[model samples]
Target chain A: MTLNNFIRIFITIIFANYINSKINFFITDYYLNFTLGFLVFSYWVFTLEEHLYALPSFCIGLSIDLLSGSPFGLNALLFSISSYIIHSYRYSFKIFSFLQVTIFFAFLSMFYLGFIHIFMNTANFSYLLIFLSFFLNGIAWIFIYILMNRFKKIFYK
Target chain B: MARIAPGNTPKLGYFVLIILASLFLYLDIQYKTFTSTKNFFNAGLIATNLAINNIVFSPISNLYKLTNNKLALINSNELLVEELELSKSENFLILNKDKLFNDNSELYKFINNISNDYPHEIATISSFDTNLYKCCDNHRLHLFNNSSPFKKGGTVINSTGIIGQISDSNNKVSEVILISDINHSIPIKSNAFFCNASGSGRPKVLECKYDPSLWKESFEIGRIFYSSGLGGIFPEGIMIGSIISIENVEDGDILLNIKSIANPLTQKNVIVLYPNDIK
Candidate 1:
């Protein structure tokens, strides 16, 4: 990758980290998964960039693990698997419109929450929260895509 | 030449891997052998947290500098001075013979006595897994506070109420199990009855199982519950939560729904209480 691409990636990672901390309000108690997971997962899938996805996912998941004091590989493993699954399907996914990506991400997010629930054996989880998170993820992904698209054109062009 | 189709081997391999990983996770949880693996992952987690903190600190610090004004700063200083003087006068009242009825010293002594009873060291909570069902139990509490005298299995608290017990302790950090964890149970009581209030691991919900025959009518909604001191985990009289509702089950047990007063998300600073009598 060129220097410009490197900087763009770095900035994305930084922005992703900021969001990870700020979005704790939504995820801390009700959702075990980070709200940032939705954003990060979307970013990787939309970019269709496989190589760049894993490290960031690991780093971000690890950061959350430390912040919340959870078992070490738990998040790293979850995030990596989530990103990889999304990455595998990136080629087939039609991302021409925001709504399409939103619907796609909503389904994937269920896997995320479901994985956590099964892992923790927690009961009475609100499906509404999962649905809300999917909606929030859609909004977040679209906004970030627009910003990142702009950055890519300005700097990479 | 004829057309060729892609083999299904890759897809099948991926599925097999997932199934294997799932089984490994289940076994790890059942056998409790993932501690070392968790610690290794935790090292990476700590590094990531530090990096994020460093990145965010600059912008937050810049914002603080941008908004700070001399007048506001001076007012804060003056308020601190006044608060210091007021405490000094309160201290003087405790020392004087004429004001012996108040006995502020006795209050201080009581507090001191309790402090001595449960000597603690500070630990910063690092992370918690919110997932409810992993067999090896993916839930863990990482903390940065390491100098705590209490080891793993020691109890933690804040000024308002009990936080959780210690699950893991290291040189510079410790992990605490929040009262919301299914693994934790504290013996609790009210003014009229006593029972064990178990954490449901669901936020804001606790279960108090009391014998239906004993003081069943006395347990009312909105009544406060306190630590009964029977579990040896918590000190007596610390507020747990209020009784939200009560239900009598066919099993002849009364279940009290307790809504925890402590909000762990907001309460960061906690005291890790270590009993003096730990053998």
Candidate 2:
């Protein structure tokens, strides 16, 4: 990658980390999972150089794993799997509606939230959180996508 | 355009990367392999975030502070309320320090007397895991006081009465083991009715069994019990609790339920007295 592209990727990773920490105040006691990174990383996969997707997805996941104190490779594995699936179906996304895409990501995020709770916080885990996130994730990203579309062009391009 | 999708080599690369990630996940789950890495990254992230937040948001934050007049008043009001509570506790402590005893050593005598009184350290509880306290047999309290050092066996007392004793202590933080712990036992006396009360693993209750035939007189309910100082851990004549109930256990022994006066859950601050001669 060129230095300019590297800088863009670095900036996006930092922004993703910031989002992962902040703006989850809506869910009081639940582990606030923002799937913005997942959403944007998949978008980058579909639009950017496809071969670069998995590596940067892994980087983003590793960053999240370190920060969120999850199992070190859990997010990396999930992101890799998500990116691989996205890469395999890159052409299909062109025809899929925004709602369809949002529905797919909602499950992905719910799995992440549920798995973290099962492995790290079994004593405090509530099944209600996972059930709630399934619906809330779709609504959250739809809003975020509308809000951050302008910035995506600058970073993803 | 061709650079957007790598044909064959990168597909194999992604597979290998995911496999490696799986291996790392196994290692991390089985044995925490990356905790140091996580800790190091966390330290760096916190420092970086703090610096970035201060530099980037300080201007807007200052502007918000300048515009909001209510926040300053609220902050001052909160401080004044907290100070008022602290002063009230101090006044209560001063007035009641010697009032517990029928002796004339009130605030006037305590003010001028140092050699006759046992010095105690006042500490605020910084941390207490309530879940662990209730569920587990081991009950412990973490206390913080920077000025004074606490030692093992120091008697911990709350505003109401005796609560626990310091099991471990350092310069900054100390751990107190509550009397309700199964391991703790206190030599208690109630108007000559003496027995070694054992903790029942229940909060505020201690268990002691006595032979009914030996005494021939039933221990009355609501009778106050005091520490007899036989254990050298607690001072003598301090009120521990009252005889709440009496039960008949197996082997013809009568069990006495001693209800403690101090509840650790209610009290925020406690005093730890180091009485070397109390034994």
Candidate 3:
């Protein structure tokens, strides 16, 4: 990626992490966790042609792991695997309807939540949390998508 | 230009990176290989946070306070009120020294030096994830000690009671593993029965499991728990918490859920007392 794109993605990732942390403070009372940062990362990788490289994805994951209390490389592993998955299905995603893609991302987020919980919070794992987070994350993604589109239009114009 | 699909992208590159990440995750979970790296990062983060608070927030708040002379006076007055509150907490420790250490005279000898003026340094809460504190098992908080360095294993207390002990220290920032943390355990007693109460991973709750057949005394709710001083970490007879509930487990052992008296989130300023210092 060019330096400009690299800087932009880096800032977006950090900002997303910050927002996730702040939002989690309120939503955890309902046993709901939104993997906003991971969703943002996935969204960017799917939309941007310049975001296909696994190295940048890995580096971003490491940055997230550092910022979060999660063990090192947890995000790194997930992000790299996610990049591979997204790249493999890039063509299929083009033909898929918006609702189908949203559901797919929601399932991806549920997997992310379950995987992180196994490693970090095995004692308090609730199936309810996974069930609830899927729908919340799907809605969150829709909002993020619309907001990003509006921001891009304003920027490009 | 269309984005490269996985089938079109170099497959070997992604495989190598995934394998590398797996190795990192394995090493980190197995051996805690990245602890020092994380700690270093945390220390830097704490320092940066402190700098930002001082450079930006403090000045803005100070200027806002300075807008009105009455507000400035009230601010100074609030500072005095805080000092009074701190001393009142210290006084509680001093007055209760006998009650707290009546059973263990050895511990009493150490607490005798708790002076009237200021016996301990006040540490302020630096970064506490109230979200994790409420929802997660790993309950810990970062405390910024601007005065003397904090002693690891020092008892951290607020006006209410014993909160936790210092688990780790990085420069002036220390980590306190709260009694609610799954890894933390404290020896607590009520009247005749004594047991090690482990963190329930629920906020302000500690669990003490005992074989029902072993102890003759029937445990009831609202019974106050006191520090047994078996671990020598906390002062003896200091009120830890009260029994809130009881549960019979599968193994025929009864679990007593004690609601801790001290809530870490309630008090931003805490006093760290090193019992070993006087010893």
Which candidate number has the best DockQ? 3
Candidate 3: which stretches are off by over 4 Å?
A154-157, B1-6, B64-71, B81-85, B92-119, B277-279
Scored by TM against the true chain B, the candidates give 0.71, 0.64, 0.83
Instruction: Output candidate 1 Cα RMSD.
Output: 7.3
Off by over 4 Å in 2: A1-17, A20-25, A28-34, A49-52, A154-156, B1-9, B48-279
Better of 2 and 3 by lDDT: 3
The candidate maximizing TM-score is 3
Error of 2 at B178 (Å): 18
**Which sequence of candidate numbers ranks them by DockQ, best first?**
3, 2, 1
Query: On residues B1-279, what C-alpha lDDT tens digit does candidate 2 reach at each position?
Result: 112333333577689779988988999988878756654555455556557878888667756766886657766886787666445434434544553432455335544442345566667776565533443345667677547657778888776667788876554567788887767888887666788988776667888888988877677798778777776666666667888899998889999988987688876667677665542
TM-score of 3: 0.88
Off by over 4 Å in 1: A1-21, A24-34, A49-98, A151-157, B1-24, B36-117, B120-149, B211-217, B248-253, B263-269
The residue-by-residue lDDT of candidate 3 on A1-157, one tens digit each, is 6777676767777898788888887888788998888888888888886555689888998888888877788999899888888787888888789998899889888998888877777667788988999999999889888876675466422
Give all TM-scores, in the order shown: 0.68, 0.50, 0.88
Candidate that beats the other on TM-score, 2 or 3, i.e. the better one: 3
- Ranking of candidates on lDDT, top first: 3, 2, 1
Model 1 misses residue B223 by how many Å? 1.8
Can you write out model 1's per-residue Cα lDDT over B54-75, one digit (the tens) per residue? 7897557656765775556765
**Cα DockQ of the candidate 3 complex:** 0.51
